[model samples]
Target: MNSVRYTWPEGKKCAVVLSFDFDGITPYLWRSRHSQSKGISEKEQRRFGPRQGIYRILELLEKWEIKGSFYIPGVTAEEYPQAVEAIAKCGHEIGLHGYLHERVDELTRDKIEETLIKGKAAIEHIVGQRKMGYRSPSWEMTEDTFEVIKKYEVLYDSSLMGADHPYWINQMVELPVQWLLDDAIFYRYVGGGASVNPPANPATVIDTWKKEFEGIKKYGGLFMLTMHPWLSGRGSRILALESLISYLKMDSEIWWATAQEVAAYHQSLEVEGKNACLTEMIDR
Candidate 1:
């Protein structure tokens, strides 16, 4: 397979971006089509994210002195301004995650633009600065979504799984994400009419993550971990995240960064007219 040879800051072997999707109750309401009565239980379940899970995650990141990228929906920020404020105050990067966690593929062009504007404004209000990154709700984006994001001048997007390395998406840097690296695939569970999947073993999840990091280290690529506070903030699962953070920190060669930092670095290289070399590698 084709590979990309990229150099991280300080000549690090690999780059790792720790990110969280702070959806809160917006996803539940969006999935239920604003039918709060039908999704009350689900909404409350997701409410744990803003109420408790985010605090736990924030505390963990603070303890490690690691700043993470947090994507928040407009409605989530509006409803829980204090929680959003706390994240910004912690020196973490906040990115856009939509106005109500609406799937971009399902919305029209106008709706997409509207949500993008509203989401950006809401996050900017809390962070007191313009957000430069965006991760589509549910990791689903339409073709028009690209145009919409560009119209808003978003610096980078993390919704695509095209490659493990950072690549260009028109004017925006594409910091790719993968399902295997997302915590929702392992920990999402809901009752009633909502879909449910069996949670994976925390040990196995962390083990897989460690192996992924090893691969990135070998190839000198970017490793983006997509997690949600509600899913990974549970008592047991949070331990796995803490362990993973500790493991990554043990290696001084790993360049830890937020999504915005990664994007800026890539942009700097592009402006310098430097190209990342593509090579083929054989696994031993």
Candidate 2:
């Protein structure tokens, strides 16, 4: 818990960031690097994201007039340029997710840096600008990942789970996330995989998210939701997201923002000397 409460813009009690990892066929290819050309079934399943899932998710965001942060792999962006371009056209923030949804921890430092550069270039090619944020493919980052991202001058990262609120890491802001708030844990299932967990009830998952939001509001912290278009864009599951959004909007005290917006706001607070106590928490 924060010893001192931090203030939010417009007198809002808490901040919320709705983030989506637009992983198309990259995850499947990453899992089976040798089967890229032969993994027809797996590839097609994952392709649902670019083919239909992203459109559905985009429609929901548009209907609610909300701008989300989308983390796209270089492969996904390259393979689905039209989908990526549409996301940009909708005024959503694009962030780097990796070159092929590769886990950074498993890569060497040089590989990590290379992937970051490639991923940024791919997104830039589609969005016409460099992304200001990053989220690791599997919430796994190497010790050198931060340094690599810093070299790129990325403004923030959403992969770490160090805290409930945004904090500085080296030269970048870290908007932390937890598995409990991620939609994948509740819905993702792989056939014939070791330790397969069945999907949880959508209503129960939404209730849990609402409870998390209420607690953040009580403490004036940030609520960051990590979602995957492939997992949560289904008709039945999307209803939970819609309900959660509607419920949150019923209260005017929540500051709904994209990850970049929250990062910029935190930076502004530091510049104004209003974030001294918050920075102290990070130091501790």
Candidate 3:
């Protein structure tokens, strides 16, 4: 497992990017695409994210005086215009997620391209400008997905778990993410005979995050946290997140930045002859 030491701006030891996937209820809808007997329990729970959870998360970020990157689906943006607008107005990065939280691997190349165009249009219509970065819905991508993103000239992608720091996937910057740092893996639990287990305790989860952050900081890698507004918007989870934020802020050597900013810096590095090694699959 190799890592790239990104030359973070301002002589920081490492870069920290907090990204939120504002899916609203799109993930639920996408999951229920095949069944007509879907229950409302999970759908309503997910709706709480846009309707209430997002605002709480926004306020928390405002209190910390830190901006986060928000990747929103087109349907989520159309459904929750106010929520999406608030994020942009508060000086956060808004990136494309998908049209309806569609799984890229499950779609054809044409469908993937259509979704990218529609998703970009939806965000631009609401925010008055197109963004540079994109995160695939459900963190799933295919060969066609990569080609479509490259065709659109997206600056970077945060869906892949390739390197610990930013790297180049051909022309696009890859800000890798891991499931260990995502909130949904720990806190998204909906009942009604659907849940396999209960959600993890927030304190325990945050402790694990802190340990990972320390390790990443020691190794001088990127600590990119992927979270959901609906899942991490809960009161206790928010408190846990704030605790982590405060703890990280105690060390002023960390470079806190948006995903786009980090990607741009990596691009700058490439121009300065700091090219990231290309990754590819080889026959076993």
Candidate 4:
């Protein structure tokens, strides 16, 4: 196996990124686009995100004095403009998710392009600036998606899990994420046919997060935590997140940053022709 030991800003041992997918009810609408059922239960569950979960998350970040990256769909932004405005006003980074939380793998290249343009425009209109990053809906990506990503000149993508840290994918930086670090997998229980099991205990989930952060720090890489307001915004879950942040704060070697900041720092490194490539190893 071969790897490159990337150096973080200020010679920090590991970079920590707190990112949120502020999906609201966009994902539900997308999934039920073809269904005739007028189910209000699931829709209301998802709405909890924009209505209350997001604000709780914002408060948590403010308490910690750290900025976070929020990826929101166009429909979500349009539906919850106040939430989007509050995020921007709080000085956090907002990135495009999709036009309707549409999965890139299910759409054609043209459709993907359409989503990108609309999503970007919708978010930029509220935030009053160009968005610098994107996280594919459902973390589904394809070559077609990458093409549109380049077309828009997005600085980074958080959908890929190719590496434990940020790496170059052509001209864009890939701020990789893992399933274990995402709260949706653990806490997203919408009930009915969509939900499979009960939500995991927040304590259990926090233990896993703490372990992963320690491992990432020990190995010197990025600790990118992907969370959803609908899932992690609950009171108990928020407390658990607070505990995790407190644990991480005890470490002085961690460079806390938003995804865009990490990507910008990674881009500044001359990975192609300099000592920025800290280590490379190959095993037979």
C-alpha lDDT of all candidate models, in order: 0.86, 0.87, 0.87, 0.88
State, as a TM-score between 0 and 1, how close model 1 is to the true structure: 0.92
Task: Quote the RMSD, in angstroms, for model 1.
Answer: 3.4
lDDT of 1 at 180: 84
Query: Which pairs of residues have clashing backbones in candidate 1?
Result: none
Q: Please give the range of 10 consecutive residues that has the lowest summed lDDT in model 3.
A: 275-284
What would the per-residue lDDT of candidate 2 be over residues 44-129, giving only the tens digit for each residue?
76677788889999999999999999999999999999999999999999999999999998899899999998998998887887
Q: Write the per-residue lDDT of candidate 4 for residues 212-231, one digit (tens) a residue.
A: 99889877889999999988
TM-score against truth, every candidate: 0.92, 0.95, 0.94, 0.94
1 or 3, greater by TM-score? 3
Candidate 1 clashes: the total is: 0
TM-score of 4: 0.94
- Model 2, stretches more than 4 Å misplaced? 34-39
Q: Tell me how far the alpha carbon of residue 62 in candidate 4 is from the true structure, in angstroms, after superposition.
A: 0.8
